[model samples]
Target: MMKINQHILDFAKVFIAINLCLVIYSFAFESMHWLLNTQVAFFSSLFITIASFLSYKRNIQSRISNLDMSKTSKTEDRDKIDEIDDPYDLYTEYEEIPEEELTPEKIKEIINDEKSKVRKDSFKNTLFSAGGFLSIYRVLGYGSLLFGFFALNNNGIFLPIAFMIGLGVVPLGVLASKLLFKKL
Candidate 1:
C-alpha cells in the first residue's frame, strides 16, 4: 500500500514538473513577449507560480479534510436508543463485577493491546501523510526552480531578481520538508 502511494506521489511530482515546464515555455515564448515590458513576464510567472502553489495547498487540504474523523463522528447517530439498550443491560448486569476482579495480568494485556493499536494507527497515518507531502513539496520545489530558470533566461534585465528567487527556493524547500515531516 505504501509503495503504491509513493508511486502515485512520484507520478504527481512528475506531472507538476511537466506542467511547470510548459508554463515557463509558454510564458517565455508565446504570450508575454508581445506585452513589451519585462514586468509582464515577471508578473505572469509570479502569478502562475502562486496559483500553482495555492492549488496544491488546496488539494492537500481538501484530501486531508475529507479523511477527517470528525466528519464520520458527526454522521453517526449517538442518540439511537434501542441499538445500545442491550449493551446497557449487559453493562448493568456486570456492574457488580468488582474493579479489583481485574488481575494485573489482564490489565497489562489490555494496556498492551491499546498501545499496539495506537502505534499501528500512528505509523499508518504518518506513512501516508509523509508520502503525500513529500510528493507535494517535490512538485512545488521543482516547479519553482523551473520558473526561476525561465525568468532568468527570458529577462536578463531581471537576472538578479531571478537569481534571488531561485536561490531562495532552496531554503523554502527545506522549510517545507521540515514542516511536512512534523505534520506527518
Candidate 2:
C-alpha cells in the first residue's frame, strides 16, 4: 500500500512538472503571440485550459487506481476473517445451538459492528468522490481564470469572451461532476 501511495505521489509530481513546463511555455511563447486577436486568444486559452483539466483528470485517475488496488487487499483481509472458524458459522459444530445460545448483548454488538463498518465505508467513498470533484474544480477554475487574465491583457477584443468562457467553467464542471456521479 505504501509503495502504491509512493507511486501515486511520484505520478502527481510528474504532472506538476509537466504543468509547470506548459505554464512556462505559454508565458514565454504562446501568450505573447496568441493574444493578437480576441477570438484567437479566447479559443487558444480555452483549448489550453481544457488540456490542463484533462491532464489533472488523468492524474486523479491514476491515484484512484492505486487506491482501488489497496482496497482490494483490504477486502481480501475481510474475506479471510469471514472464512475463519467461528461459532457463528452455519456449518460449524455449534450449528445446532439455539438462538438463545448467544447473549443478547453479543448479538447487538455484532450488529453494531457491521453497521459501523458500513457507515465508515460509505463515508470514505463519499469523501473520496467529493475530494476528487473539488480538486478538478480548483484546477479548472484557476486555469481558466489565469488564461482569461492573460487574454484580457493581450487583446481587448477577446477580453469579454475569454472572461465569459472562463466563468462558464465552474458551471460546466459542476454539470460534469453531477453526470459522473450519476453514472457511478
Candidate 3:
C-alpha cells in the first residue's frame, strides 16, 4: 500500500504540471484550441469529487474485529449472557489450530480474513460509484449547452437548461441515492 501510494504521488506531480501548462497555453494563445476545456474539466472534477467523497466515507468505516484464536480457550464452561439480544453472528470465530499443525491450507484462512475485511468495507462504496457519476450526464449536458448557446447564440434557452441540470442534478441525485439506500 505504501509503495503504491508513493508511485501515485510521483505520477500526480507530473499530471498536475501538465494540466497547469495546458491552462496557461489555453489562455495565452487565441487560435490555440485547448483539447480539454474548462467545461470538460468541471464535469471531470465533479465526478472525481463525488467518488472521493464516497471513498472517504468508506475509509472511516470500521469492521467487526475477528477473534485471535490463540488467546481464547476451546472449552465453553457456560453460556454467556447476550445483552444486545441479537442472534446475528457479528464477530467471526476461528477454531484454534495448533501452531505445529499450521500448513499451507491453514494459511489461506488468514489471507481470506484480510480480504473479507477489505471487500466488506468497500462493498457499498463500490456499488454507489458504479452507477453514480457526472461524466455520463456532463457529456450529454455540457456539449449540448456549449453548442446550443455558444454556436447557435441562444443564451436564454441554454442558461436555464444548464443551471437546472448542472447545479440541480447533484443534490437531486444525492437525495435519491440516500432514499434508495435508506441513509436519509
Candidate 4:
C-alpha cells in the first residue's frame, strides 16, 4: 500500500513537471510584447520551479503523516486485543510454542519459525510503476520539436526559441522538484 501511494505520488510529480514546461513555453514566446524578453522566460521558469517544489513537499509530508497515523492505530489495536496479563505473556498470545520447555531442538524450531514469519511490511517495491510517466514528457518534447522545425521553416523567431525552452524545461523542473522535495 505504501509503495502504491508512492508511485501515484511520482506520477503527480511528473504531471506537475510537464505542466511547468508548458507554462514556461507559453510565457516566454506566446505572451505580449513587453514580456517577449528572455528575462520573463527565466523568471517564469523559476516561479514554476519553486511553486512545484512547495507543492511536492506538502504532499510528501501529508503522506508520511497519514502512514504514521495508520501505524500507531495498528499497534494500539494489537495491544488491546491481546488477552494477556504479566509473566508468561512474554510473547503475543497468538504464538504457538512447539515444545514443552526451551530445549535445543525447541530453540531451533523457534528461530526457524521466526525466520519464516510473514512480514507484510518487509516487502520491497518493484522497480516500475503502473505505467512509466516519462512517455508523457517524450510526447511533449516531440511535439515541441516538430513545432520548432516548422517555426524554423517560417519567418518565426519566438517559436524556435520556445521550442528550445520546452525541450530542456522538463529536466529543470524535475531537478527543482528533487532539490526541494529531497526525493526522485
lDDT of each: 0.51, 0.52, 0.46, 0.49
Q: Note each model's CA RMSD in angstroms.
A: 13.9, 12.4, 15.8, 12.5
Pick the lDDT winner.
Answer: 2
Question: Model 2's lDDT to the true fold?
Answer: 0.52
Residue 107 lDDT, candidate 3, scale 0-100: 89
TM-score of each: 0.33, 0.30, 0.27, 0.28
Q: In model 2, where is the ten-residue run with the lowest total lDDT?
A: 32-41
Segments of candidate 2 deviating more than 4 angstroms = 1-60, 67-98, 136-184
lDDT of candidate 2 at residue 47, scale 0 to 100: 52
TM-score of 2: 0.30
The regions of model 1 sitting more than 4 angstroms off are 1-77, 80-98, 136-184
Candidate number with the higher TM-score (1 or 4): 1
Top candidate by TM-score:
1
Better of 1 and 2 by lDDT: 2
lDDT of 4 at 73: 44
Across 1-184, the per-residue lDDT of candidate 3 in tens digits comes to: 3455553344344445444554565568622223233334434444555455555444444221443433443224323443133224334355788899888877898889999989985996675544344344535554554553364234223333333333333444444445544532
Backbone clash count, each prediction separately: 0, 1, 0, 0
Residue 32's lDDT within candidate 1 is 43
Encode model 1's per-residue lDDT on 39-64: one tens digit a residue: 33333444445455555676678667
